[model samples]
Target: MSVAKKLASQTAVYGVSSIVGRVLTYLLVPIYTGAFAAAEYGVVTGLYAYVSFLNVVFTYGMETTYFRFANRLGTDRRELYDRVLSLLLVSTAGLTALLMLLARPLLGLLEIPPGHEQYAVWVALILGLDALTAIPFARLRLENKARKFATIKLVGIVANVALNLFFIVLCPAVASGKWLPALQPLVTHLYDPTVGVGYVFLSNLFASALTLLLLWRELLDFRFRLNLAVLRPLLGYAYPLMLMGLAGMVNETLDRILLPKWLPDNFYPGQSSLTAVGIYGACYKLSIFMSLVIQAFRYAAEPFFFAQSTEKNSPATFAMILKWFTLCCAIIFVGISLNVEDFGQLFLRRPEYLQGLVVVPILLLANLFLGVYYNLSVWFKLTDRTYYGTYIGAGGAVLTIVLNFLLIPLLGYLGCAIATLACYFTMAILCWRLGERHFPVPYPALRLGLWLLLASGLVGLGWWVQLDGWWARHAWHAGLTVAFLVALYVVERPRTAAPLVVR
Candidate 1:
């Protein structure tokens, strides 16, 4: 098989774990929104925003560090894995204990209700378990155990979904009806309807615990070793990556965290801050189509980039991959944006939460930029200039904070969307410019710009042109989507001269 074909097959394998898993978990957005009020859902949204940041802290770049050492010349892969595993075990236990002990203070910082403090304990446990599992998962990837990697991920996601259904769906039915009267007391005792979003947290906790069982081999296989010789260099290589991950999380999730804190009373005087958070969070989930793509690409791209760095034609291959990645994202952006209502009907459960739908397209574009930035970021990682990643991510985080502070009060959730878009676009451009000076890939700038322009033009035309009937409107937008696809084909017509398989 050709190198390109092999790369694609591996990427597909990675996608099964990332894209499929995220889609399963993402399906819960509609269910949660439908079952709970916007305010109730907001509790889930806001708390998980903090989870994203804290997970970065708890994991502390051990996964990337593992990949780095395992791939390096003369490095003892087992020693490095065992050292990473040992370090994480210690750190995870300590962090979990600290967070649980200071639950009240942490809850207070988040403005969480006093009764909901159990959420803190649950989150701590979840983060700890997830952090402990990080190296195992990375080990699977490093060893080319993609099937095992995918199985574990799918198991977690499926377990989470099943648990969600049991707690959020069946428990409510058994509690309020006589259909399961024998188990009604048990259901009533375990599941409190008034607990609201706590079930979301509980489901996550249970699912994470279940995943640990599946990874027993990985967890138990490692020796307990944390040699200073290994630890020093690992930290040297990883600290900058940890900083990059933390700052990236800030840009990605700070809007959800800050939106409620900064929401103005005049915008919705009667509704609580959580209500605003719920709406924004639900709308943001609509951008998961883009997030899933970025995630799947990242999973496949990282190892591929590292392995290919030594090849003679690596730069040309990287450039080709970038263009193809751009094309995929452009197609996704156009498909999702032009067919916004189509997706809404499928996943958007509550009309109330759809108030922030305007942000969907904006956030899709933002996430696309974020994905492109990830592709550009290979230069820093490859050159051992990972600190440059820290700079770019930190700068984006600053822009994210400033923009959200200024815009959230004035524009509400829309401010959050705009801020995210600006942050990512600026970061992508900056990273590309910096990359040109350091470890450049000949990215087709004009071709990529035209692809984006075509998508934007289609979006604009769809918005401007009016159709009299609902059917007519969908038909028009659908036609525009087809036209975008055709434009893509025409632009890449030269490649199709030789069929992909030539069968």
Candidate 2:
């Protein structure tokens, strides 16, 4: 198979799982919004944002390090696997224990509600389990076990979704004697209505635990010994990645975390900061289509890039990948941004969440840029200049923080949406500029820029053109979306020409 074909096949498998699984989980938005108040859902949003941040800390970049070293010419892949797992096991244990021990203080620091002390412990366990399983999953990717990876991911997502429905929907009906009066006694034993939004965390914890259980055989091959020969280079490489991951999380998720704390009371006139957070968080799910694609591509691309680093045509392959990736993202950006209202109405059961729909397109565009940045970041990873990722990510994080702080007071979450777009767009540009100097790829800069410009114009047109009837509005927007794809196909039609290369 050609390199592109191989990557595409791998991405297809991963993307199917990611898209299917996330869409399944994404379906719970209506359950959450319908059953809980915005303030209640805000807790779910806030807690998971911390999980994203701590997940980086708990794993500390070993997954990527494992992939990098394992693919080296003469490395003992099994030994590397054991050593990496051992390292993660030890560190994860200590960190999880520390988190458990300091749960009360951490809760206070996070400004969590008084009675939800159990949330801290549940979150710590979830984090630790996820961290422990990180290497096993990474190993599967390195070995091209995409099917197994997808299976495990789907299983976990299914379990999570099932649990969510049970706790959030089924149990409530049973307890209320509305749907299944016969199950009331059994449901009461299992479900506490007061737990409320806590079920979201509980569902995740159970899913992570189940995933770890499924990966037990992968862990059985491990022996708890850390060789400094491996440890030195791995840590040397990984610490910077960890830093980059942390900063990247800041750019990605810190807005959700800070939006509640930083925004003034009554900023939205009768809406609390937490309520604003809930609404923004729910609307933010509207952008998951972009994140889903980026994540699936990252799964296939990272290991593929490293393994192909020595190939003569790898730069061309990388450039081709970015061009097509950005085009796909641009299409998605326009398609969803144009239909943001429909998505909001369909997914967000409550009307309050519709208020934050304004941020969805901005966020979709932001995530599209983020995917481009991921493709551009291969240069640093391939060249073993991972520290450059740290610098770029840290710069983006600073920009995100400063922008969020400055704009939250003025424009609320729209400011956050703006900051996210600016941060990721800047990072993508910076990565491209730096990559040209060190590991040049003949990226189709002009073509990709023009496509994005056209996509943006369509989105603007969708916004500006108001229709009296809903069907007319949608028909017009759908036609515009189709025109985007048709135009790209015409412009990018295949030709008998040599592929562009940097050298």
Candidate 3:
């Protein structure tokens, strides 16, 4: 099979796992909105934003490190595995303890009330468990064990979703004497309706713990070797990736973090700023259409690019891949933007949560740029100039934070979306500029720009112009979507990429 075909097959398999798991887990959004108020949901969003940063912290870019070292690139696979596993075990334990100890101070840093201490501790535990498993998961990726990887991931998602239902839905029903009278008091103690978002955290904690248990095979299959010599170089390589990961998290999640504080309390008067956050968080899920696609692509692309780094004409290959990826992302952006309103059956159980839907298109576009940036990022990763990634990501993160600070007070959550779009756009541009100097990929910037503008304009037109009839308006927008797809085929059909064989 051709390399591109292999990549597609891998992406599809990974997508089945990630996209399916995400879709299943995604279904819980409505259940959550139904169970919790906007403010409660907002608090959940804020805590998870902090968790995203901590995940970056505890994992410390070891996934990328493992991939870089354990593969054909840097070190003996078994030796690299043991080195990373040993480091992770020590670090995970240390960080988990420290985070729990500093939970209150950490929450204070996040501008969260210290009363949310238990939540902070839970976040600490989740990140540590997840960090512990990072190298194991990367091992699966390196060995081309995509199916096994997907199974484990899907299993975790299933467990989390099941626990969520039991805690939020079934337990509530049982406690209320609506389903199981025998289990009423027990469930009443276990399930706190007013505790609201805590259940979401609890469910995740249990699921993560279970996943660690399931990963015992990878953890225990080989004896962990303590090689300080191997450790020093690995750290040297990974530290930059850690910085890049942290900065990337800020770019991706700072908006959710800042939205709560900067969005005024007056918007919902009696409620805290979390109400706006809840609305924004729920609306952001709409952009997961693009995020899921980007994630699945990354799952395949990261390994693909690493393996391909030694291949002949790889730059051209990366360039071709970027074009297709960009086109795919543009399709997703258009798909979500056109269907944002009608996707109500799949989104927002509470009508009040729909207030922030306008952010959907902006975020979809933002994620498109993010996907492109990821593709462009291959230059630094392959060249061992990962510090460049840190520079790029840090710049984007700073821009995201500053823009959110300035705009949130003025425009509410809309400002957050705008900031995100601008941040990713700037990052993509910078990555392209720097990448050209080091590992030039002949990415079709003009074509990509035209497609994005065309799709955005079509969607934007539909959004701005309120057609009188639902059927007529949707049909018109739907036609525009078809036109976009048709145009994509017409432009690219005649130009077939040569079968890629680098090894």
Candidate 4:
């Protein structure tokens, strides 16, 4: 019970940043959807999709490697940190430079507008800064410095949001002499209207740089060690994780990348492929609510899991965690998917963006499965059979690529949503099965499946029963959601009567 409370408390602290910062950042979705055309927003979407893949390459699984080795007996914690950060610094430098050097050609390949060549360069810098800070942030997690981590994360996000509003909203208004006429001259000198959506990337770059600056103490502590004895083991363990991460990013972001290429012209009837990409991308932000929950849990759970690896009761504790995690995610899946119309109208400012709302529920459920997979993945990591993760992730990535290729032209972005769902569902099931053999946990699979089924059934019921008036329809959905909570309480109430512990 105490352990669970500790995990929950840490999750809450991390949630302060992940949930709050994401919601703050999520607000920008509306601004972008309203401010730019779907095609223009597609540029932002496509570029960031590429950045996700590059991010995996930049850090190359060193963060988790640091946590693993740092906790191992007889390992020099300071030496581990130094070697990890040193490798990351050297790799990030070379990768960012190479990215910048090939920026134009890369943009050309992606079919980015010619004048927007700077996007690639800005993206490289952002990735480099983020990669460099990964170890510092990991150290904070390992040290149980949740408050500091949350504070730094929130500060960076606030800065990003403020800058975005400044460059994208305030500057445009001022330069046009609509608001702050007195500042028009200065704004005109500073803001380039031609930059347009480029300001989004610029705001992020500035924010990343700010984040790196704030982690100066961590950077200053680096002692620049090149001990191959220490590094060889770290790299050996991490290279597989890097492969896993690259493949995971493919499962996560490749749809956005492929949708622009594989989506046939005029599939949406009068909308270009890029416009479809923008619409899909905007609606995809709807999944961030669930993603934020998973991310917060992960921020707390990863290190917590490592620390608990030696406990006799760890497997049972993990099983208990998975049960509750799935239940919460299931509720979120239903709540968000059922009210997706309201959410779409609220966050997606333009009507065209709403055309992709059909994908929201699909995506929300997909993310739920992804979260489950994250929980099941502890076995491989703890057992040091991380190659299993590489295999599982690669299988999912291959599936994502194939499904996107085959379905994008036919079903449009709906195909991408389906592919994501299938990929995650398969991965979660596979991980559970594989974990049973190596690191058996008595997971309540049947109960968890039933919970999901009940949630899915309620959503299906909400969709079936048509009611007039938006408020009345929402009332029915609320009633259904409440019923699920009631059922959940009835089932888990007795379990809570005693502290969950190993006998």
Q: Residue by residue across 1-503, what tens digits does model 1's lDDT show?
A: 85566677777887887888888888888788789988888878888898999999998777877777788899888888888889889989999999999888877766776987899999999999898888898888888788888889899989999889888888988888846877897987788887777888889998899888899998789899877775998899888989999999999999998887898875866678888888888889989988888877777778778888888878777777777888898888888988787677677788887777888988999999998999889888889898998999999999999999999999999999999999999999999999989986777877687778879888878877879898999899999999988877875877744322110
lDDT of each: 0.85, 0.92, 0.85, 0.91
Flag clash pairs in model 4.
none
lDDT head-to-head 2 vs 3, winner:
2
The sequence of per-residue lDDT tens digits that candidate 2 reaches over residues 1-503 is 98999999999999989999999999999999999989889888888888899999999999889988998889999888988898888899999999998888767755776878899899999999999999999999998999999999999999999999999999998888899799888998999988888889899999999999999879887788877775998999999999999999999999998898789878999888889999999999999999999999999999999988999989888888998899899999999999999999999998888999999999999999999999999999989999999999999999999999999988999999999999999999999999999998999887788889999999999899888798899899999999998997777765314543322
TM-score of each: 0.96, 0.98, 0.95, 0.98
In the range 1-503, model 3's lDDT, one tens digit per residue, is: 97888999999989998899999989999998898888788878888888888888887877887777765544678877887889888888999999899888867755666467888888888988888888888888888899988888989999999999998899888977889799987886777776667888888999898888888899888686777785897788888999999999898888887776677768656656777888888888888889999998898889888988988978888878888888888888888788888775567998888777888999999999999999999999889999999999999999999999899888988999999999999999999999989987777787778888998898888788777887988888888889989998877777764422222
Model 2 ranges with Cα > 4 A deviation = 495-503
Question: Which wins on TM-score, candidate 1 or candidate 2?
Answer: 2
The list of candidate 4 runs beyond 4 A from truth reads 498-503
Query: Worst lDDT window (10 residues) for model 1?
Result: 494-503
The Cα RMSD in angstroms, rounded to one decimal, for candidate 2 relative to the true structure is: 1.4
Error of 1 at 225 (Å): 0.7
The global Cα lDDT (0 to 1) of model 1 is 0.85
RMSD of each: 2.8, 1.4, 2.6, 1.7
